[model samples]
Structure formats: structure tokens, C-alpha cells
Target: MADDFKVTDPRTLRAYAHPLRVRLIGLLRSEGPMTATRAAAALDDNVPNCSFHLRQLAKYGFAERVPGADARERPWRATARTTSWDDDSDDPAMRAATDQLNSVLLGVFTQRAQDYLATRADEPAEWRAAAGFGDMLVHVTAAELRELTEQIEALASRFDDRAADPAARPAGSRPIQLIQLAIPRGPVS
Candidate 1:
């Protein structure tokens, strides 16, 4: 899969802003390629519905069918490990599309967090200890904050290969979402 899918067109952004499509892309990224039927089973939805959304995703180049399979059973795979767009776009249309996509993503992230909390007690001690929320407040200029973001991204990229290569992951490893958010808590001084 490609490293990143950078969406610049507002139409494409709006197309990808749907919750189901977002979740489908996430599934493809985390679990590697799978047929629409399998994706539907994992997401607790129907094959026809999933297949439709997968086609929609493909319309904008977010996903593609894998080779070596017949039409009915061909697996669909994400074109990128991550989807990114400019939230700071000057174009109003672009900004609106970005906001819509972010809104859908935030809901997904929140639900995932809640799901983890609900099942935390049943998880292994090691996982429970390793997983939890964390936050930090810092004072920094825009340049410094940019630098910090780059640093964190670089560190995370170390594990990017593991997403596509199951063998690269060590034993007991599983897909983990690491969200990084750095926003101004108050107006700039």
C-alpha cells in the first residue's frame, strides 16, 4: 500500500467524509486487505452495504481491488496507510470538507476509546498497563509545536512497516491507535 493518500479536492474530501467509508478505510489499514463480505462481517454490517461503500471509496482512489481473485471474491485494499488533508486550507469548500471528515473521525475515535474502557477489565494485565489515555500541556510557539509534531510523527513511523507486514510485528502485538492532537487551548499570547 502507498504511504499516504493526500486528498486535495473538496469533492473527494466530501466523498470520504462518510462514517461507514471512514471505518472501512480504517479496517483495511489495520487488518490489511479483505473482501467486502469479510469486512461486512467484521463491522457487523451486510455485504451489499459494505460492497457499495467500498465501491464509493474506490471511486476516489482511496481503495482498490487486489489481483489474483475473481470479481465476487476479490479483496479490496486501502491505497494508503493513512489519509490526510489540509485542515488549514484557505478555500472555504476545502475547509468545510475537512471539518466534516474530522467530525466523523472524532466520533470514531471516541467510540473506540469507550469500547476499550468497557472491556479494559477483561484484557490481559500487560495490555491494560500498556494502554490508557495521556495528556500534556505545554507552552510553545508555532514553530516549536510544528517541530514537536514532526518529532512524534517520525517516532511513530518506526512502526509503520508493521501495519502491512504481520511477521514484522512481535508476538502479542495487535493494532493500536495512537492519536496525537496538539491544538491551541487558548488564544495565542
Candidate 2:
């Protein structure tokens, strides 16, 4: 699978902005290939709903059918490990689509955090202690801010291989969601 799926078309971005579609792509990317029925069960969703969404995702090139021994069972796989778009697009449609995608992503991130919090008490002590929920406010120019984000991404990429290959995961390894945001606290000049 490709490492990054860069969306340039607004329609493609909008197509991938749906919550279910986003989650479905994530499932395929992280867990390897599976049929739509299996994906639906994993996501706690129905077959038809997921089947249609999976087709839509395939139409947008976010997913594709994986060849298997059984012709009837067509497994779907994500085209890339991560889906991203250029937030600095000059096109109005691209900007609008990016905004929509970002909004959906923010909702997903919020829900994940809330879900974790709900069962945090039941988690292992080490995991509970390791979970992070902290942010820092720093003063930096736009260039410096960009540099900082790049540095953080580089660090995170060190673990990228583990996601695609479950065998590479060490014992006691569990999925962790790491969200990063660098919003300007004040109005821009």
C-alpha cells in the first residue's frame, strides 16, 4: 500500500469526508484487507451500508478490490496508509473541501478521546499513565511553526511501519491515537 494518498480534487476530498468512509479506510489500512461484510461487522455497521460506502470509496480511488482465491468474496483495501490534502490550495473548491474534511476529522478525534476517557478507568495502569492529554502554547513565527510540525511528523513516521505490518508490533502493543494541532492562538496580522 502507498504511504500517502494526496487528494487534489475537491470531489474526492468531499467523498472521503464522511465519517463512516473515513473509518472504513482507516480500518482497511490498519488491519489489512477484508471484504465489505467483514469490515461492516468490525465497525459495528450493517453490510449494505458499508458495501455502498466501500464502493463509493473505491470510486474515489481511496479503496480498491483485492484479488483473492474466492471470486465471490472481494476484499477491499485502502489505496494508502494515510489520506491527506493540501490545506494551502488556491482553488476555492479545494479549500472548501479541505475545510469540510478537517471538520469531520476534528469530530472523529474528539469522539476518540471521549471514548477513551469513558473506559480509561478499566485500562491497564501503565496505559492509563502513558496516555497523554497535554498541550503547550508557544510563540513562534509561521516558518518556525511549520518547521516544528515537520519535526514532529518525522518523529511519528518512525512508527509508521508498525501500522501496516501487525507482526512488527511488539508484545503489549495497542493502538494509540496521537492528535496534533498547531492553531494560532491569536488573530493573524
Candidate 3:
């Protein structure tokens, strides 16, 4: 079984936000152990570039080279299930970087959604039913909001790990969009 993990530090978030670093982490988390070469192939990137980012991910404690895993076949996996940042910080640079990273990631997800929708015509019926796209507006307190976010993240992680299954996958077994929104009714005291 995979270990339970959490990251709630700004430094960790910054480290994991690097484009290649995040891609590598996602690759390992989804595909399991893999050599730098394999990771590169999975990401459609070069080995040296992937290796460099992998080392950076390790430096931030987001990942580690597996033991008994060959040095020549350096495989890595995420040390944490989630990475979070403290929004109360006053550091300008940290704030800017975090915002930028968030924006870029959002863009990535948007592109992925567009691509998925574009290919839906080619997808099979079972897959179309299994995968869905929708949004909801909910009213909740701060604590309730956080809990909702965590629940959604957990649900997404479950599906993300299912791609490795050998069972026959639905034709549209590709990615799906899951956007959640929780707007407060008024200003908090």
C-alpha cells in the first residue's frame, strides 16, 4: 500500500511547482517506479532534463530515489500525497511565485480539458458515461470548505492512479474535468 503523505510548507510548494518537477512527480505517482529514461519517455522530454528536475524534487523532500533501485536506473516517487502553501505569509516573492505556479497549472488543466472534449467524438459510450464534466456552487463555512476541497482532491487522486490498471479501460478513459467552487455569501468578520 502507498504511504499517507502531506506537505504544508511554502518551500515544499515552491519546489514542487516547477513545470518539469511537477510533471515528473505526477509521472511517478501515476506510473510507479521508473528510470529517468522511462520518465523522460513518459513526459516526452529528455533524460538529462528530467534527471535535473528529479534531483530538485528530491532536494525539496517531494521525492526520493528508491533504494535497491539501481543508480543507473534511478526511480523516484512522491513522498507526499498533497502539497499546500500558507496563504497568510507576507513574503512578496513567495506570493508571486505561488500565484504564477497556480495560474500555469490552471492553464495546463484547461488545455487538458479542451483536448479531452475535442476527442470525445472518438470515445466509446462506456467511457463517456464513466467520465463526466460539471460544476456546482455550494455554501459553506471556512472549515467546511477546506474539508470539501480535501474530499475532492482525494477523489481525483483515486482516478489518477487507476490508469495503470490492466483491465480493459473504457474508450474515453482519458482525463476528466472536475471544477469545484465555493463562494462565501458575505465578508467574514
Task: Return the top candidate by lDDT.
Answer: 1
Q: In model 1, how large is the Cα lDDT of residue 186?
A: 88
Q: What RMSD, rounded to one decimal, does every model reach?
A: 1.2, 1.3, 4.3
Tens-digit lDDT string for candidate 3 (15-91)? 66667776787777766778789999988899899888888888978778887886566678777654556554577
lDDT of 1 by residue, 64-181 (tens): 9997878667899999988988878899999899989888888888888998999999999999999999999999998999899999989988997787788899998888889777
Better structure of 2 and 3 per TM-score: 2
Off by over 4 Å in 2: none
Tell how far residue 21 is off in model 2, in angstroms: 0.6
| TM-scores, one per candidate | 0.95, 0.95, 0.71
Error of 1 at 187 (Å): 1.3
Candidate lDDT (C-alpha), each: 0.91, 0.89, 0.70
Compute the lDDT for candidate 2. Answer: 0.89
For candidate 2, lDDT tens digit of each residue in 1-189?
Answer: 787898899999999999999889989987889998999999999999999999999999999998653788889999988887889989999999999999998988888799889999999899989995998999999899999999999998898878867788999898877899888888876
